[model samples]
Target chain A: MNKLCQSIRFVAPFLLAICCIACSNDKKLPFYGQREARITKAADGTEKVDTVYQTIPPFRLLNQDSIYITQDAFKNKIYVADFFFTSCSTICPTMHRNLKTIFDAYKNNPDVMFLSHTIDFKYDKPSVLKKYGQKLGVDGPKWQFVYGTKEEIYHIAEHDYLVAVQEDQSAKDGYIHQGWLVLVDKHKRMRGAYDGTKSDQVAQLQKDIAILLKEEN
Target chain B: MRKIVLFLVMSTVIVTLIYSCQDAEQLEYQTYYSNGQTLYQTYCQNCHGEKGEGLGLLTPPLTDSLFLKNNRTVLACIIKNGATTPVTVHGKTYEEKMPAFPKLADIDIAQIIVYVTNSFGNKMGMYPYADINKDLKSCATR
Candidate 1:
């Protein structure tokens, strides 16, 4: 009985130390948010977020003015991008508000660009997006609201960006999508994705952009 | 020897308390509205404005008093199916097209609704998930 008690006493200290370490690490690495992100395999089997160089595929979209835009539109600029439709009464509003802060924060910086893509191309026509942009006071050339075919939008959202964008009749709202803000480097590779509606995460996103911009290409 | 044993037990208790405290704060909101407020800012603030007044004319003000009173059904329907046509709230007309959130569950809708209804002084009482589920079924017909 004495031996068993001593053994337990010996083990208890070690267990307590481990618990303290674990509790601290939990704060350091949360289950969701900026720190939890990991580079993983994409749908096409290519590794997502290659830090070596920007190798993302080109995307063709229409600007708010109904002008055609390719990936070349973002050449040599660090940009933040997100997917949203205009009429959404849910997360899109909060995400837009959060991005607005980041946008206003870096509005004067020439290197920073903001891209908002519309998943509902059928309704979010270029003119409509332009009007929406105007309403949000988003002066394009620094910020661009994009629209494209539904298939194209969904494809980029799922395969390229690895974000959730699904269409389902059974969904309570009749469709489903994720709320994510993707950060892309000048080379068009995703450097990070933050919760678009989080002030702190967006703040971190701003910090990361500054970091990425300073890095040598 | 007593000191060492006491230190270990104290450390274990402290660690347990810390973790339990964090888990409680992160998950235990009695109302989803309080939780949804953070979720809204995390996800909807960009286009909606930080205050939920919306991003200029791009989005409509959830704080509109008369609008909220008159368009409960429209607001609920718009949340469920999204909107393309111009939805006139008060006298001002907003025609911006927004995405549908078909994946949001009844509970999520209820929380967001309650949040909107309460946050901007547009009080309509606390909408329970059960009520939202019932309203959603009626919404499906029209």
Candidate 2:
């Protein structure tokens, strides 16, 4: 009886160790928890506050084809939107590069889309935007380059989406705006915004979009 | 017989506990991008290649030793505040102009750099984001 008890004790611990290792490496918890949390938080290190929307504003603009466009064109689609000018000498290139990633990812998903709004309506006429789109290699139809009146574009940029867009004549190029990508749901509510230049933030944007897509419609 | 069995059981339990109690190395593993890989795919892969190898005839490769060792300063500067002149990497000259990444915060640059360095077989030691932040001031302002 004593020998049996000793053997049982010895085997029990070995089994427990194996069990612990197995549990620690469980496939279900594949990602590190700390990293996941960081991705889910805000840049200021606080938890992100989700914005609820009651209505989406309406506006008119020109598409890359020189056709008249409006908010109604998006009707019921989930779209990712951002503001940039064709000749922007700063963050615009990086924004285009980053957005290309999102464009490629959902290029086949007919329901998902991209809207690149030009802050330089004067320069970014359909022809200019079409050429710029060619340079960036934007997948046609999946991504639309939009141009509208400076006043209306600036108004929507600042008030509606809360993005910064201004004409800064003092600064060499006479334009200024942060590089931001806003994700809007089917209902036209702002679900999230991402730093178009940073891949990690964009990835978080992708994840948030996925989350938003999964939400009950 | 019972005494032998008990001895064996106790030995097994001790061995298990001893092995399990070993402490893990205290290396600090930063959670980069957390979503960095995904973000890289979305924003950087188009120009930098899906793996930092640089797009052919368009951009220079980051993973190449020529650029990594020679132009670390210029590279850091260019990323923060776009590049103008044609630069060389791996002994070959690259003429493609890379635009600046000004909208990117200090942390974002760090994460992208780390992602590029570690991935695509670049393997530059994991530099802290703070270092990038310090370097960015001189690069962008100048």
Candidate 3:
């Protein structure tokens, strides 16, 4: 009886530890935006319910390389996306500086990607973006700096990514915008949004990227 | 034995305090330097970077001691009024127009100059706030 009690005490803690680990492994990043359940009849006459997640819609814009790219370019890949202009001197420098660290950290990982959309419709042409990208040390395919019309870019920024941007005459460089480094999952759903200018938020973004990568595989 | 012990303890305290004390000049430099660090973070750090390494080729790095020395007099003016002219730093030319900071006081500019020149691999000694007015006058006349 004494031997059984001792073994049970040891085995019970071991089992509890395994349970905790398994629970944590099952933990996944939360899905942003509204979701809904869809009920369907299965082949075996049972109901199968699935949650439909809001996803990044279709987008085709000019890249820094002067080539047109579509949403299909990021197919099966997770990406970090942000909006800024070449001449913005306010938060953009700090944002890009912090994001550059993340880019360097995940440079070798092909599945991870970066996308920057320029909101300046008047001046930020493809050639300017190319030069900016080259100077920013992100002249490659993994990090695509894109440019689009004010209508398309602003519409998508407001409706799709949930970031706010506008042109203000009194603002610096004639524009003002938020600095959100949005993290999107493999399915193109936003998993996290971190303030690109804050060190703590950027660090949290680094950790959350690892979590999302694990969740993807 | 107690006398020896007290002497040892007293000497240790005195030595520590003496080594920790900053001289008058050092105290003045520290006043500028520490305040300058905060100001740099607020104004220049975004473009110049935390290490003054500057971003890619878009912004010029502040590590060029020669350029700083050659343009040391006009540095205050450049801070006050933006620079549209291209600048050659470390053998590379940066053409982007630097936005002006008209809000900074002369003393604030002096503090930033001291901090930047001292940190980021730069060893230029203290730039007295008293000398800044003359430099600003020189720049305005140019």
- Name the candidate that leads on DockQ: 3
Instruction: Please state the interface RMSD for every predicted structure, separated by commas.
Output: 3.6, 5.3, 0.8
Every candidate's lDDT: 0.74, 0.70, 0.90
Better of 1 and 3 by DockQ: 3
Model 3 CA deviation exceeding 4 Å by range: A1-15, A22-27, B1-22
Q: In model 2, how large is the Cα lDDT of residue B133?
A: 61
Question: lDDT tens string, model 1, A5-32?
Answer: 9999999999999999888662221121
Native-referenced DockQ of model 2: 0.05
Which numbered prediction scores highest in lDDT against the true structure?
A: 3
DockQ of all predictions against the true structure, Cα-based: 0.32, 0.05, 0.73
Candidate structures ordered by TM-score, highest first: 3, 1, 2
Rank by lDDT, descending? 3, 1, 2
Task: Rank candidates by DockQ, best first.
Answer: 3, 1, 2
Model 3 C-alpha lDDT per residue in residues A16-79, reported as the tens digit of each score? 9999999877557888877899999999999999999888998999998889999888998999
Better of 1 and 2 by TM-score: 1
TM-score of chain A of each: 0.73, 0.73, 0.89
lDDT of 2 by residue, B17-132 (tens): 77656422112223563445665665566567665765433456667855565555555577667777877676656664566667777677666666666676665655566787
